[model samples]
Target: MAKLKLTAGRVRAFTCPADKPQAFLWDADVNGLAVRATLGAKAYIYQGRLNGKSLRVTIGDVNVWSLEEYREPKTGKVITPGARPEARRLQALIDQGRDPREVKAEVTAADIAKREKTKQANTPALEAWQAYIKARASKWSERHKADHETMSREGGQKIKRGRREGMPDKKEPGILRPLLELPLSSITRDAVAGWLEQQAYRPTRARLAVSLLGTFLNWCSDRPEYRDQVNPDACTRMKKDLPKPQAKDDCLQREQVKLWFHHVQRISNPIQATYLQCLLLTGARRNEMAALQWEDVDLTWNTLKIRDKVEGERIIPLTPYVKSLIDGLKPARVVLLHSDDALKRSPFVFASATSTSGHITEPRIAHNQALKNAGLPALSLHGLRRSFGTLAEWVECPAGVVAQIMGHKPTAIAEKHYRRRSIDLLRVWHVKIESWILEQAGIEQQKEETLKLKKSTAA
Candidate 1:
C-alpha cells in the first residue's frame, strides 16, 4: 500500500495499471479512507477491521465527493464534510462495537416506514372501495357488482343515449363520488350524515348507498391494512333520517290485461314484445328472464331453468304461449349469425346483438310506450311479474304452486318441509293459470291435448 496526501489533481489522475484489475491510493489524513480505481471507474472507499475481521464499504464517486471539507463561499456554510468524515464516523461506530452496516439498514428501514405511513394517511376512499369490490366481486351477482361500480363512478362521461335536446351531454357524478374522493380516514359519521342530507332528493337511492357504504366500512375494518383508517360506525344511525322505502303496487288489473296485451304485442321489436308478454305469463324476475341462455330453455321437456337467487336454480314449466314466443325469437337469432351455419344460434334466448352483455338490457322504454298507447296506467316490468301471481288467484291455484313457480322462498312448514310437488304437477296448475290469463286477454292458445300429441310425435 502507498500512503499519500490526497489532493484534487492527484485524485483525478489516479488510474489502475493495464495488467491489474484495481488499484488504491491511501490517504494520509484519514486512516481508513482511500481512492480506489478500477479499469473503468474511480471511487472513494473506506476499509477497517471490526471484530478482528476486515470490513470494506464504498463511500462515493471520486468526482462527486471531495477529498476534504467544502464550504459555500458567501455564507461560509458547510456544504459537505466529504468522504473523509464519513469514513471517520464508520470508524467511530466500529470502535464502539457497533456495525455501521446495521445502523445504515435501521435508518433506511425507518425512512421507508415513515413514507408508507404518510402514503396510507393520504390514500383516497375510492382506492379502498375498489379494493373492496375486487375482493368481494366473486361472491356477488353481476347486477350487484355493477351496482357498487355505478355508485362509485367519478362521472362526467359522455352520455351515449337518452340525451334530451336541452340537457347536458355529460353524465352527472355518481351518488357516492364525493365521499369516495375524500381520504379514507376522513369518513366520519358526521361526514356520512352530511352526504345523506345532500342526497335527500333521492331518498331511496341514497338509503341504498348508505347501506353499501356501511358494508364497505365493515369489510375495511376486517382488513389489517385498512382497519386503523376506517370507522365502521360511520354509516350507523344515518338511515333513521332517510324515509323508509314503500313497497311497489303497480300490478296490472284483470280488466286491463286485454288492453295491455294488445299494445305489448304491437311493439316494433319482436324480442321486446315477447319479453314483456313472457314477464306477465311466467312470473319470473326481470333479471332472471333477461339472463336466460339458449341452453337453459328446453322446449322438448317444456321446462325453463331459471337461475334463482335463493335456491341456486329452479326449473319451471315453460307454458304453451311462452314457448311459442321463444320459438318466434329463433328467426331473429338466425339473422344474427356470423356464419352460414343454421344449426348455430345466439347463446341468449332474448339475444341482443348491440348490447354489451349479448342480451336485452333496457325494455322499459318500449314497455312504457306500449302502456301509454293503450291508455293504461303505468306498470313496470316487475309489475308484469306481480300480475302473474295476481292472475293465478283467478284460477284458484294453490299458494304453494305460485310460490314454487315464482322461485319464492318457502314460508309455510308444509311448503318447505313436506310439499315437494313435481314439475308435472306444477305444469298442470301453471297451464290452467296461463289459460285463464289468455282467456281474459282474448288470445287463443293451443290446447294441452295438441301440445301433448306434438310432444309424443316429436319423441
Candidate 2:
C-alpha cells in the first residue's frame, strides 16, 4: 500500500484507473484513514484489523466532509471535522478488542430507537383517536360513529342556519377537541380532570366525552404501537369529579297527546312533521327512524323493517297512520320516453335537499318550537318513543308484544327463548295501540275490520 499525508486538494484530485473498480490513497498520519475513489464518486474510508481480520468502513463523501478540525460556534466545543478522527476512534475500539462494525451497528440502532421514541412522544391524541375510530368503525352503527366524530371535530366552520344575530358565524369547537389536540403521552389523569372541569357547563356531553376517552385509552393500551404512549388509567377515578347522570322520564301523557299532535302537525316541513308522528307511533329510536330508507317500508305487507341496535334488524307492523304518512312522501312515478331524463329519487324516506345526509338530521329545533307552541314543558324525540310504550298499556297490550314491537331486548327467559311472534301477530296489538293513541289525540282512526277489508279489496 502507498502512504501520503491527505489534503483537500490531493483528495479531490484522486482518481481510479479506467480498468480498476476502486483505488485508495492511504493517509501517512492516520494508519487506517484513506481517500477511496471510484468511477463516479470519491469518499473517505477507514481500514483496520479487528481480531486479526481486516475490516473496512466508509466515513463520508469527500465533497461533504472537511479534512481539518474546528470549533463549533454554538456550543464552543472542539469538533472533529474529518475521517482522521473517526479512524482514530475505530482504532481505539479495535485496541479494546471491540469490532468497529458492531459498534457502528449499535450506534445506528440507538439513533433509530431515539428517533422513534421522540416521534411517539410528540404524537397527538387526535391521531390515536382517528386510528381507533377507523379500526372500530365497521362494527359501530352510523349514529355511534357520528357521536365519536362530533366529539373531536375541529370547529370554526360556517354555519348554514340558526346562528344568532350577535353570535359568530363559525361554529364552536367540539367538546373533546382541546384535550385531543394534546400529545397522547401527555394525556395524564390530571390533564383529563382539567378538561372535564372546563366542560362542566355541559355535564351531559362532558360525561359522554369522558366515557369515549376512557374507551379510546383502553384501545391504545391494547395496541403495540400506542401502548407505551398512552396512560390507560387516565380516565380512572374521573367520574368522582363528574356529576352523576340523571335518568330522563319525559314521556307524554294521554291528554297531552292531542296538544302534541296539533302543534307537531302544524310544522312547515311535512317530512319533519310525518317523521315526528312515525317516531311516536312506532316506538322506534330516533336514529333508527331517521336512518329509515324507502326500501324498509312495505305498504302491501303493512310491515316496517327497523334496523335494530339489539338485533341486526326487527320486523314490526307499519300501523295504518304510519303507513299513510310514509305513502304520502313517495315521489310520483312519471311516464318517461327516456330513462336518463327521469328524475333520480332519494333512497331515504324522510329526504332533505339541504342536508349532506340525504335524510333529515336535526329535527330538535322544529320539535322544540312545536313544544313551545303547544305549551308543553319539553319532550325529546325519545320521549315520543317512550310515550308509545307507556300508552300501549291503554289497550291492555301484552308486555312481550310491546317489547318485540319496540325492539327491546327480552329481559326474561320466556320472552328471550320462546317468544318469536310473526309480523302479522305483532300487527294485531300494534294497530290497536296506534288506534288508541290516535283516538286520545283527537284523531279519528278507521276500524281494524275496515282496514282489513280495504287490504283484501286492494289485493
Candidate 3:
C-alpha cells in the first residue's frame, strides 16, 4: 500500500513514485479526497472515487497548489477539508445526475460574455463601429465594403482627405449616432420608430437614415453576441408610421433627354462633359461608370461589362460613339481621370478628385450644377438611367429587353422564377437605347447608321 507523509507544520505531500508504473493512495484516511503527481515532469491530480471505481481529476502542479488554498466545491460555498463530509455530499449530487463542475464552468463563461457586451455598449459609437468592423468585416465583399464606406460618409459625416490638395472627401451625415452606442438589448422598435419620425422631419434624409439603420440592425443580428439582442418590442402605433424610402430612380423622357443631353454637352468641365456623354450612350449607373476601370471594359468586343454594377454584370454593347468617347479620353492607361488615385488606382471609368472612385462622387452637386446650367429642375444622376429606360420604351423595345439590358433579373411569380435568355433580347435593347440617344442628341439617322438588329417578339 502506498502512503502519504503528513509533514512539519501540517503540510501534506504525496511522495511521487520513482517507478514507471505505480499507484498511490491519498486521503484514504478521510472521504472526498484527491491525489497529485505526474507521468514525467508536470504533476497532476486524481481525485474522487466511489465504490471500487476511481475518477481522475487533474489539479495542476504541486509547487503551485498550496494546502491552505484548497477548499471543497459543494454547499454553494468554500469549506475546510475537515468538512470532507459536505464535499462528499456535493459530489453525491453529481452521482445522482448533477454536474456542479460543468454548471460552474457555464456560469463563469456567461459572466465573461456578459462583461464583454457591457464593454462594447460602453464604448464610443464610432469606436464600437471600429470594433464591430474588425471582428466581422472580413465576411463582406469588396463592393459591400465600398458601399459601407460611402454610406459612412452619406449617413454620418466623418472627415477624411485625399493625397491631392484642393480636394476633401465628402462625408455622410451622422444618422447612426442615436443608436450606435446603445446595446441591441436596450434598443426598441418604438425608439427606432421615434428616430424614424425624427428622420421624417427631413423627409428625404429620414428615409435614407432609417433604411441604413434597419440594414445595420439586420447585420448585427448575424453576430453571436448580438443574436438575442434584436429588439422585437416596439410601440404598435409607431410601427405603422414607418416612412417609405424614396426610390433611387431618375429615368427621363425623350423631350427631357433631348434637353439634358444638350445641357450636359455645354458644361464647362470637360471631364463632366465626357462623363455625361458616356452616361447617355451606355445606360450605365453614374457611379458604376465613375468607378470603371480599363480592365472592366472589353474594347475588342465593344462591350462594357460591369461586374460590380448596382444590378449585376451589365453587358452593354459599345456603339461607335461610345468607342469614340473612350478613344478621345486621354490615355491614363488604367487610370480614371476623374478619380485621383493611381494610373490604375481604381478600375473606375468615372472617378472624382475625392473618394467616390469616379472623381464624380456627389450626384446632387452635378445635378444642381447641370440643372442650373441647363435651366431645369435639379434631376438626379440616376434620373439619366431612368431617362435611358424611358426612352428605350418610347422606341417600342420590349419591356423584358429593356430590363435585361439594364441587368434586371426576370421572374415568373412569374417575374421571380422565370429566366429569359436575353442575348437575343439584348441585341434589340442595344438598337433601341442607342437609337433613342441619337434621336435625342438630334443626330439624324445616317445612311450607314443602320443596325440590322434582332426583332423582339414580346410586348
What TM-score against the true fold does each predicted structure earn? Answer: 0.87, 0.85, 0.60
Most accurate candidate by TM-score: 1
Ranking by lDDT: 1, 2, 3
Q: Itemize residue pairs with steric clashes in candidate 1.
A: none
Worst 10 residues of 1 by lDDT: 449-458
Give model 2's TM-score versus the native structure. 0.85
Off by over 4 Å in 2: 7-22, 38-41, 49-55, 63-76, 92-102, 161-169, 332-342, 447-459
Candidate 1, residues 331-355: lDDT per residue as tens digits?
7773344344344457888877666
Quote model 3's TM-score.
0.60
| Candidate number with greatest lDDT | 1
Candidate 2 lowest-lDDT run of ten: 449-458
RMSD of each: 5.2, 5.3, 8.9
Query: lDDT tens digits, residues 266-307, model 2?
Result: 899888999999999999998889889879988788898899
Query: Candidate 2: lDDT over CA atoms?
Result: 0.85
Ranking by TM-score: 1, 2, 3
What lDDT score goes with residue 344 in model 1?
Answer: 46
Off by over 4 Å in 1: 68-78, 161-169, 222-228, 335-344, 446-459
Residues 1-459, candidate 3: write the lDDT tens digits. Answer: 444432222223445477745444454433444444445433324356445555554444544543333455565454422223434544675577655455557889999988987776555444435555566579776665654444444343344432223444544455656655555665577567657767665556555555545656565667675666554333334434655555676556666665666666667665567777777666677767776666777778777776645465667676666665665554533444443434555445554444544455554455566767767765666676677677776677777666666666665465556655554457556766786677665655555544222222321
